[model samples]
Target: MSRLITIDNGGTLTDVCVIDGQQVAYTKTLTTPHDLSRCLFDGLERVSHEVGDARSLPALLRTTDYIRYSTTQGTNALVQRVGPRLGLLVDDPRILEDLAREEETADLYAALVGSRSAVLDLGVDDETLEGELVTVCNRLAAEGASRFVISVGGPDGAVAERRIRDLLLAIFPRQLLGAVPLLFSNELIGGDDDVRRTWSSLLNAFLHPAMERFLFNAESRLREHRTRNPLLVFRNDGASSRVAKSAAIKTYSSGPRGGVEGTRALARHYGLDEVLMVDVGGTTTDLAMVRDGAVDIDWFGTVAGVTTSLPLARITSHGIGGSSVFHVTDGVLGVGPRSVGAAPGPACFGLGGTQATITDVLLLTGVLDSSTYLGGTFRLDVDRSAAAVRATIADPLGIDLPEALTRMQDTYAARMAEVLRTEAGPATTIAAFGGAGPMSICAAARRAGVPNVVIPRSAAVFSAFGIGFSDIGQTYRTAAGDRPDDAAVTAAIEELLAHAERDMFAENIAIADCELTWAVVDAAGATTPLGGRDDAARALKAGGRVQLQVVAVLPHPRLEDPVAISHTAFESSGTRAVADATGTRSEVPVVDLARQEHGAEGHGPLVVEGPFFTMFVPDGWTVAVSGSGDLLLTDIPGSSKEND
Candidate 1:
């Protein structure tokens, strides 16, 4: 079993992939947010047995050298507000003063506002900062501040934090620093955006306790399976890296990274340099552009409404996942926004979900054969599904239950297609990864008019498969400060480079083994190279208004061609009618009418079945079916003429 097994837990699905040299095996499991590793390892166990002899599970794991996992644990913890109350220690004066004065959500991190210990603000002077750290650290420790984030207001914040942190450690003792997870803002942001920097630190602090618990459990489970190698988690920047007790933020985007990396692998296999990837799961639909076998880096984008202006992969996500609900109101029909989540799941799953859902409609319409879902882990209650849909949508719309069911499936397919077509644009091919993605890809592709599609082997756990495909890499960027002079800019550049080196070293990356690249976007948003012996050349050019970008990769580490990812442009939106998901049946009709009207003109029509709402598409759209059984739609304008 001299192989490596990896698990990727997305928001809605868990992907498992086992690799030995080039040979591989994979499987998928529904994500259990409460204890993700349990589901992840269970999936790995299932896949390993399928790949080898049935009796020797330990032998299989022992033959495996390492077990890597990428999880949405950090991201979910943030969204769910499932972690410790934190205290922010801002070393810089203006930043903390503004943060304290500004209202909660002023920077939009609403949940942890009242939750943060009052800012332990230290004035700008070095002497004042030293005094403040001792007092604040003692108070925070006393107040039960489980995590501490130290941020300083400076262009080279990372460099500044390192100096100040050592002083804090000297005063507070290394054991105290370890007891309370301390996140230095500069180290995480790698640039400047007071709000974003603050957000990053806060989010990391929030996930600290939960991540520790999850990782420890995963580590112990691996040991029990006779795995001697330490566990590693892949970073969102597309690289495998070891995780000490402290680095939890790196796991936030891990699931999506794996999918993008796996897509890159597929592109090279097909000799294609540009492509579009669409991953549709139970809670979100993520799309990305791949060019030259790598994801495009758009440093200036928003995630969950927070601005993270770092140059990582360019990907967009929407709230279109598998558990979308179905409903009808005021003589109109719709589906999704609400879901039959894991516990109850789809009505057809027979796990006691009484509500009607898209899976129910699919089963009623014969689009999904419940007997095949998860290889029949649970039996399908087609009768229960019919009763639910009939009671909710069909009866309300005054349409036959069967007709309503057909429309429900078709409409959802149409909406998915519109999203894929708009986001995928006129790119090379469409690749789908995720448990539901392959099943939905074809339907979406037909609607988008995309002619080529790839559902690589192990499409369900593609993200985990991608874990082994990408090169080890990291991203860095900087903000513009008011220009004083070339010398000032040079100082800034030197400071930034020094900070990057320090952070990389902390992560055990060798400075010489990494490649450094620099790019500058001027005040007018024009890009230019800042090539010179002096690192400050680019930062100086954009003084006070420039955006500096850098990416480092361990090239040729494995002595293979860099995966070519063909880049293409795509556009999409993430809108789920949250009110509908949690609303009562009486509210269904009005919601259905409003959503259906909105849906008719877009890619899909709106489907409403009691508390659920699903996306729908227009008439001219066609969908493609991928090998993994995903239904994808493509927007093929004027194709109606040929069909007519």
Candidate 2:
């Protein structure tokens, strides 16, 4: 059987999903922040065992046809403002003066230039410019700036940037000892927006070293196993590229990019045109919108409240999740922007944690089965959950245990509902996933005014599954002048395609295995697909300035067959007592989804257990098991099916 392995290295946990032909297996383990590779290998071992392979790490790696990896390390690094110290080299002195005139821009400029940076008035004589450049580089290096970003402002920005790069190369050659790395703004982004381009280049430079270290380390391990396929890393641009070709900034929130892809696939399967994807992870809750069967793409993504011109999926992430810390300040309960993380985890994990978290609240509210959590591999501490709730919430508000848990969940659900309502329209369908999604999805959807909700069987490791469904691809774009002739537009497109071809060739993807497509964006921000070179040229000749984007889709081993539900039944495991959102206790039938046959149907007030997730199907809803092991939940009383 051919095997495909994909791993998502999240903040609180590392999820591993393996697809071996028609069979699938998944496992989750705590993220080892000190060394992510440890958790990666650990989860791999567990997944291998679940597949009944029992092979060694290198042995399993050798047999795996392709491995796709995604991580949240860069996202976390940006959030925490932790990375290599950087220095900025600006060609124009007026740009710094302009930035300093405004408070907001001044703060952003400070962040971009960092504490150790130098500005050069390169318009001066070449002798003076060269002397200043050397002095600035030496001073910044002395001040501990290991990474440098060179951005030149004004009309001659590109020419000046290249000149600065060349000068730096001469001073610090690749073989030179202790040579610092420098990034040129024009090389990463071709747009004329100097500020945005500078920020993009700076972000990329900051994230490069750490991402390179971890990914290369992982790739080396795979190479030692004699794997033939190069490791592919998922990018936020909805494509996968080899480690050498990928930019670190492109990988931010890439795990959720997978979820968006999975959402698109599911939308196609169900024939739905619009859906809202809600991915709840341990550290954050990410939300994205899909309309008219297309996922939204933000060509200029906002990172850390700063706008960057990076082609990324439009995803809004809130600091609320299973591991989000819960606190009562001034007798007011508040959910978190702070997380307890995987080290201590939530109070229920019994790992010496004392802080109350959303996970602890879920356990106290009966949504999570203490004994069957993580497939019963690790047991949760009920006493700890109750105590944490009492200490952090109940005692502060002079409320009881149940009331405290109820308030916390209500607050969190209300917040999530508000985010959804603000970001999505009433006609959109809600698809929720992640380890903590199902427990809170029903309440959040109800509060947000959404009626339909669908939870896939692989909800816990949904992002990793999305990684499995990715295509190896890359996108390139170049500016096309206004009212250009067909020949000009055609030449621009060919140039972008040529760049993509060169990149793919370096990645070992042949031209025959690739498909090329093009789109042209007019001056007013309207995009039209190019039918052919003539069509593109004609449109450009007729219209205003345009931007040509070319995408090259390359071949990769993917999971093409429909996932099948196992025939095993859950009657032997029996039922269990669980509580609904209303705080009413009821004995619900506990069904092991792995044992359920295809086309099985059930009603609410039941517990549907999958490999790594637990779903609390409430009353007034009907659940159907698809042939592909997906849990389709539909509202029975107030549901309305809308056409695309």
Candidate 3:
């Protein structure tokens, strides 16, 4: 129980970071989508070897204090619309109309439910209704519905829902093999809003099977390795909880939430007021904002454009990234909302991929080296990348390979630049992270009119590293009806605290170590401070619905403050005439960061290469070292060039 391990499992890559006090050891592994646990240990084994003492897997696990994980698999699955076939069962038609009111919601409903839906009339007799339920269930089963959502609306909806549940249970018992999972909206949330609760249940049920399968499997494997601490899942609420206590809906975009935490950390470190973080992963480029030194949050979480009842950090995940498929639509190049995840990855991976991606473009354009990619663990094939570009991009566009390559790079950077332009302002400092984040960030930042750039020394694994700041915690909420007296509110708070105590006790955490904070939240999302019973009564006496929310936290070790360090080295490994996203050619020197001192500062016309990432600083920018050992890229006053 000496090291704290955090793993950020992404669509294409899995990053593992081990923090033992101030000493950090990290590594990356290509995500194996077929068996997630395989990549989980692949990264763990590599990082264990990288540890200072070179502990073995069993030894590292025995001495690990906590293992926290965040993943983008659920986000990718939702984006691709891959999951169990759902058949929605509703008593009222209004629930369906409200869910599919928007065009986006309509598409989601169509994909998740399609025509395999049924509405039951609860006004009929139980015997007749039971027959109707059987017919609807058989029809839905014949229509290829493997999962079901049972939702009801109006004042007596809960009672109707329960009746339907009892009938379904009698019809289909859990003892049977391969029983269809039925999710009820009322069980998921007690909110008055019908649409939000239904959407939340739909998403949770859709994401549950895969999350439970992979997370529990991984945890089981860790136990086989004899690890002492249980795996903690990093949630979108900026905290960690045991896998059993975590909800699938809360895991949506959780990986990006870690990036938001890192952005907040960097912003506070430099005293910056506005920060824009671009986490360029394999399948998505997630954009998060830190305004006035705080990460933005959405109380009503939106996943894949549909609003959910849970609260989540507001991170815009645009489906354009290193592995996003590039296509020619109506003779114009367009990037994606689709990606070739890790299985067949980029064409440069030489893994039987034929589609053109930004990774292929970067490889052909010399931004990513064949011999130095992925810490030199894997080699990229330039010929394969070229063939993919020519077949998928160049020939279709009726252009030469060079021009096609330039156009592809231009389009990729342009799309990212457009996103940055919308999120950035004069005071914004761009934080570039992820394996592919720094590839074209300089050009993208230049296009978006941002001058200062920050590349955290651990940028490639920054999300995993950021999970170190989260404490083991969870939030509990209960609706207290339309309006209530002090006793009702008191009972609600007591019930919530009792639930929190049981959850914390399961983690072997004492009640004394866990700090509890409670508040009264009104129907409209307004919060009243929890001081005494009088406060809750007065706040609710005005006659409106209210809920009692309590958050429990067990503090963890925080990141030690950055210390001052002087320049140690000014050396170059090699030189190459490289063309960047800005379409400029220069003789750039490549320097290995690992070979330099802890806080090495330099000026460009150079490429700073680390084990897991590489940053190309153009001639006009100066790369300096922050006290935290992170790279700070600032433009030289008179040397900034305007885009041609």
Candidate 4:
């Protein structure tokens, strides 16, 4: 019944959302990538100030019942290739052969494990095997393996991996200085697939150190303030648990997953069947689908080209957003996979950045208001944006400033549209959120042939809002095998539930008070909810192929019914000069949502400026305000889509 705090820690910005009774307040802080905890508390302090009663950090934390956090640290690590180098030991060389066949896997294998791999002769005696294992492992350590993975490819390969792990531990004791930690594939997943299990282990080992360092540091600092609840980490599996109970690999892309969770809830509320989520932030544009008001879980998800036996949400990330660098090399224009991140941000931020990003170009083209942007707490530098654009874009392309800006706008829209088209379907509606999502979504949607776009009033920090009411829970799963034996299935359920109970106990949740939902997932990713365990087990006995998944949740505070839809509309407050592609300027209506009522509707050539973002509705698109204060823009068929 206490207040809740939810955070989405992104590469460029960290969002904080605080919910109390019927009121919600949120704020954003530039992420301190050098020290993540800095931005965390910075955001907390800023949002705390935004609260009416809770005007300080201590007061906010003292009254906070739950603190849920999701971060992009693991995703950035993989994309930046910054992690511990791993040494792999496999009994069969065919495992590596099978993995190296795929081009992506080969490149990933080369980057993470590389030549620091060894194949052992399992036929040897214990003494011979121990000697070889010690020698090979030590050699790998010499070759720069801060961590080691042991995997054996067979039905009883897990047992084999354990045997090798024991032998290696004795040779290289953990207490010794610089003794690399050993991780086994069986410990990370329950699957029988050798390659997936190995990759899963490898990914976890690579991400574990960085996650552990920052999360623990953040939690310890909060504890110093005598905070009430322990910090909870929101996982990619749509559940949250304490940092100690979390896996590093599961934290991958967790920030974006928060956005998808929000999008799914919005879709269900609107009764939208198929919706595309475009969560554009300063660092990346994360894309996902909410089909039938539910986001599909990828039982066998692929992370950065390496297939892992992890149940991940079906989402993809493209490195394009507000501060994404522009490339005009060889007269070919392109956006980014590389971002300016939080420190330097865009050149318009007056942070000494040389890169020209979408943010700068949009400002130059008259869509974003420099003075009133970002709540007007800090005014953007128009001169800097123009200079950066001219130097990086116009000079390189040998074109005038106006022509370069137009080209940048057109190219970014085309690329964004192309990305959306890849996930296109009939009746597909677009839900755009985040700081930069609404900026180009109308154009992108029109170009991609998507009919309508929805922008939440809380779009700027919607991800943090989505995770605001997340319950503290963890999922326990185990492979039940092809043929479901009632006894076997029951035993698996009991074991997994027992494990879940143990984990929940640490969070001060009683198993009896927690809700337990059961389901069975097959190798091919078909899931069936269990009505009654025994009856369903009997029914599935013939069909056989299934694994038991049980989730234990301790329900947390949630918002009651939100504001109902309103049919009210308001007129634009004023007009601003906006530019077209051909360098012609025209006056555009400006609607300030803060000073006006919700449910305001109008046609294109108008700017809706909020505290955190600026959205432009071009000609051909009709914008309406829903009762819930969200912007619903429907594209008129045969309207000008390219000039938006």
Candidate 5:
């Protein structure tokens, strides 16, 4: 039997899963922030111990068909400010230069600068741009700048961005110098959010060096274990793509993606049309939406407080997690954005962390296992947890430890519930995952008035299972001109589709089975069904049409520009207010229904679980699992293949 290995890097632990074609064995270990790979390898080794094949484990895992890794390397890099002071070079340096200047004003600018390129024309001359880029690179290199990011103004100028990066890299390979992970603004977001995109790119650069070494070390360790398969790294976007060399952004929020994917699958299995997945891990709580067994992807989700267009699920993250440290703020009681990370974890772990944390409260209150944390690999110190809670919370609130702990938990749950309510609205089932998720899911769901909560088997391994379920997808978007005509919109779609094809080709995806889908949100933000312009126009006119927005959904993951191309496109004024009287403001039509045929088998009350993630499938619902292994929920079980 082929073995599949999945790694989930939680805030305080690294959860590893080894699936021998069917039954899965899993293990967890403390995370080593200084060297994350240490925990990754350790987790894998432990899993090998469980399966009784330490010597042959690596070789078996190597010959395995798939290997997926999910971690927070990029996320950590940004949080710690570990990268070199970045010097940004822009095609148009007005706004970005100003923002960079402002950041420098806080006495934080050790070495950073922003300058405009000498190239003046749209059709960039390689000779001039290359020379100028090399000059910029040399200056930054000498001034102790270890990382650099370049952003040009126009959205369609990828060739220019590539040329500039290639020239600079010729002077510095991965080993010779710290990585300057080049991300062209246009390449990442399709359109221009120069400042935000540049910030995203810079953040990626900051994470590159650390992640490069981490992946290499992991690869080396795997080789020592006789593993020969290429490492399949999970991207923040819920897709597993092979890492060619070293790209750091791919691993950010790996654990969260697993939750989203698992939720999507569960939704399909149980036929739940709308779901809100809440996963509380040691470090953070993540909330995401799955409508009709499909999780939404913003293509460019916000990260580290910066927005970029990456193929990531639309997940809302809060600082509240299992190991979040608790403190009293002016005697009002506060929970955390700060966590008792891995080395010295929560007081409950008995690892020397004296801080009163969520885990401590859970342990003291009998909500968590005192003996089975990490399945007994690590022991919980109930005494330390109780003492910490009493010393910190009880004294501050002038109440007993139990009461203070209960109140603190209530407060955290209330805040999380409010956010979930706003995002999920009414009648959405809560599918909770993560080590702490099952323990708290029922209580949180009860508070939120959510009627159903589903907890699956091996809940801790849900994220790893999700790693097996996700598809490779890309979404490309560009802002439209204020007054776009149908013809103009059509032209834009064609251009985007062409670009999508090119991108897919670069990724080595086949063209025969590929498809194109488009979603257009004009300046106004209204959506029109693809090629249903007459219907869209009528909807707009019905409410004294002022303006409209448009969005398109492509069913195929192989589609190049999932958001930019379609023949029968959705078009509107681009805004809710302009969408007329009808609330059908955003229309998504299946341009190629054939793409949906790749359906996966599912059942009611389906519980899709993964390492550190779980997706609850409600009862009495039928879902369509597509050829891409994508889930689509239907209200009436097995009634319709297409949602529309």
Candidate 6:
């Protein structure tokens, strides 16, 4: 049987999902930031055992059809601002010369370039310019700036940019040892907006070195395993591309994009068009909207408040997750923008962590079972969790342990509710997933006034599952002027299509099997499909100016769908004391979903345990197991339930 594998390298965990024809296996391992490949291979080895394959990289690689990977490392780097020091080389010295003359403008320019960046002026003198370029490169190198961005202004910037690129190549000579990497603005972005182009180049240059190190290392490991199919990397554009063709800027928040794609698939299965997708991972919670059965794409995406021209799936990310640090600040409790990552993890993990986190709160409150966490692979320490909470939150506030726990849950639910209220429209269904999604979803949904919540069986590694579902695709775009003639528009579109075709050919995708589609965005921001018709170009003149986008999609081979789950009977494993919103403890039924049959229905005050996650059903809620093994949670009528 042909098999497909996907791995999502998250902030706190490396999730692996393997699909072998009709069977599927999922697992997670602690992410090793010091060396991510270690955790990646570790997770793969464990998953291979579940699929009944030899526990060796080469064996699994030879048997699997393809592997797709997604990661949040780029987003983390941008948010933390902890990348290589950068240097800016501007082709036009006039701009810098003018800014230097004005103190206020110079300060503003410095702020824009950041404190760690060194900006240099490239004058018109060819001899002096080459010398100046080398001198500045050495100077920036001395100051610890190993990566450089060369941006040129004016209409002829591309030509001047190429000259600077050639000069840098001659000086640095990439073949030489300790050679620094240089990025050019015109190659990454096509536009007259000098500011946007410069920012894009700077961001790309900052993220390039680390991304290259990890991705290329991972690729080399795969090659050692005799993997023939290319290792596809997920992009923020909701598609997968070869590692060589991917840009680091396009990979920001790419892990969350996979969740968005899975949400779309779920929407299709359930026949719901409008839904609110919430993905609660260890480090962040990502929210997005699917209206009319389609996910929205941000044509002009933004990273760290800086505008970029890369097309990305529109997802709202908040610093709330399972590993979010919880602290009492000035007698006020707050959840995080800070996380106790995989090294120490949550206090409940008992790996030398002292910080109280959301995970600790969940364990202390009995939302997670100590013995059954990660299906008994990783045991949790409830006592450690309680002690951390007592020290960090309870004692600081002079409140009892139960009250402090309740307060933590309340604050977390309130924050999630606020985000939902701000981002989601009224009367939207919520589809929640991720390792932490099921635990907090009920409370967050009730607070957000969402009536229905669906947590799929593959919720823990849902993002990795989504990566397996994505198509191999690439998009090319070019800027067009106002009222351009048909010939100009035609030529531009042809150029983009040709580029896409060439890229696809390199990836071994044939022209006939691939699908080509085109769209034009006018100056007024209205997009009209070209539909392979040249007549559509006439509409561009009416809208002022336009830009053409051409896309080529090569869909992955379809595998067998998930095996249907049969409902035989409902069996309770045991009873556990779970705390409620009021901090009162009561015996709650713990049901094993694997033992339950299709159409199995149950009441609330219970824990529906799965291999990867656990769902807490409150007193007034009801749940049913679908034929596909999906757990559906709903509120019962005439029953009052307090938010947890």
Q: Per-model C-alpha lDDT, please? A: 0.60, 0.75, 0.78, 0.80, 0.58, 0.74
Q: Quick one: RMSD of model 5?
A: 14.1
Better of 1 and 5 by TM-score: 1
Local accuracy of candidate 2 as per-residue lDDT tens digits, 91-182: 66665565445576567556555567667887786667778888888898898888888888654465687777767666565675246877
> Which parts of model 2 have CA positions greater than 4 angstroms off?
97-112, 115-136, 153-156, 163-174, 325-334, 337-339, 395-412, 480-495, 522-527, 532-572, 580-584, 638-644
Scanning candidate 3 in windows of ten residues, the lowest lDDT window is 548-557
lDDT (10s digit) by residue, model 4, range 1-644:
56889999987678898877536788988888899999999999988989886478998898887899999898889888899999998988988887678888898888899999999999898789999987897799899999988887765565577688777667665685246777878766754477888888888999998789999999999999888878999988778888998989989878778888888877876778998889887777888998997786787888887778887888877878877888887888888878887568889889888888988888888888888888787778889999998888899899999999888888888888888887865489899998899888888887788878999878899888888645676765455545656776676556666877788888877777777666666666556777655644554455443344434543333433434435455577889898886878899899886665555567887899875888998888887766556787898888665644
The runs of at least 3 residues in candidate 5 whose Cα sits more than 4 Å from the true structure, single-residue gaps closed, are 20-22, 52-55, 98-138, 146-148, 159-193, 220-228, 245-247, 325-338, 367-369, 395-416, 424-426, 472-644
Model 5 alpha-carbon miss at residue 60, Å: 2.8
TM-score of 4: 0.87
lDDT of 6 by residue, 1-644 (tens): 45788888987788898876435688888888888899999998888777673556578778787788997787777666667777677755553454335564354335434443445455556777788877777777787766777777765565577888777777666775146777878768754366666777777876766577889899888988888688888887787877887888878888888888878877776677687788987777889888888887676677766666666677888888888888899999999879887668898888999988877887888878888987887899989999999999999999999999999998988877877776665468788898888887777777777767778778888888777767778765455444566666676556666777777787787656776655666432335566653534554434332344333443332422333334344579898888888899888889988888767778787888986888887777777776556777776657785643
Candidate 3 accuracy as lDDT: 0.78
Model 6: residues with Cα > 4 Å off, grouped in runs: 53-55, 76-148, 152-182, 325-334, 337-339, 393-399, 480-490, 523-527, 533-569
Residue lDDT tens for model 5, 310-409: 5467788788777788888888887788988764888877778998876676555543445445544567898998888888888878997557866776
Query: Which candidate wins on lDDT?
Result: 4
Least accurate 10 contiguous residues by lDDT in model 2: 554-563
Full-model lDDT, candidate 2: 0.75
Clashing pairs in 6: 567-597, 567-598, 568-597
Better of 2 and 5 by lDDT: 2
Full ranking by lDDT:
4, 3, 2, 6, 1, 5
What is the TM-score of candidate 5? 0.69
How well does model 5 score by local distance difference test?
A: 0.58
Query: Residue 499's C-alpha lDDT in candidate 3?
Result: 72
- lDDT of model 5, residue 611: 33
